[model samples]
Target: MSLSLFIKYIHLFALGLLGCYLLRYYGDLNPVLASVLCGLLFSFLPFQSFIKSTKGQGAIYAGTFAAMSSSRVLNSINDFVLVCILGGLILTLFEGRFEGLGGRKGMIAFLAVAAFYMYRSVL
Candidate 1:
């Protein structure tokens, strides 16, 4: 497979595993719910939207790591930083204007990162 396709598959697999973890621990739902939720969260909605709308596939690819991080597969500041950086990358890439980022966009990003970390902590 091409490098890009390989990476995409890896991301999908990671997303699937994340779904499994979340359903088992966080969602406390059935296995079928895992597939449905992961499909909606990772494949159909946010990540896929990024792939369609921008050249920031790298950011999407990177941001998907947040799911893996949420799975508690790794525990480190580095993983947190990775999610933060990639979240910023996505915001910058899509918005195409970085000025006054300490305003609305920055707050949104902060909230998103905070929410992810909070959810992971609870799981």
Candidate 2:
């Protein structure tokens, strides 16, 4: 298969995995609701370039979902904080290491803080 086609399939697979993770772990909604919301969220993201680029978009989506999924299982504030910090760092390094997130430091920091705040409040 061509490389572009491979990347497209990878993106779809990642989005599917993210959807499943959300359906299973999302606390604010039922499984069906979570699936629908996840679908909407993924659909809203720009996919044209994502499908063509070999820049770890799939890993980004999957890692973000996995990190968010930890909220349902992490029991204590300490666990939550540690997971957020370490998971975010790991995901960022794993997915964004080569391109360095295209220099979007502010956006990355904002998402990290926002995720911590949301999970902390829920826990």
What TM-score fits each model?
0.35, 0.32
lDDT of 1 by residue, 21-80 (tens): 566557776644554565455544554553544333433333433443334533554545
Clash count in backbone of candidate 1: 0
Candidate 2 RMSD computed on C-alpha atoms after optimal superposition onto the true structure: 11.9
Give per-model CA RMSD: 13.6, 11.9
Q: Which ranges in model 2 have alpha carbons more than 4 Å from their true place?
A: 49-123
Candidate 1, pairs of clashing residues: none
| Backbone clashes, each candidate | 0, 0
Considering every candidate listed, which one attains the maximal lDDT?
Answer: 2
Estimate, for each residue in 1-123, the C-alpha lDDT of model 2 and write its tens digit: 244544444445345445545565655565445645665566567776653354444434433444344444544546444434543454445453546445343244335545655766898
lDDT of each: 0.46, 0.47
Candidate 2 clashes: the total is: 0
* Candidate 1: regions farther than 4 A off: 48-123
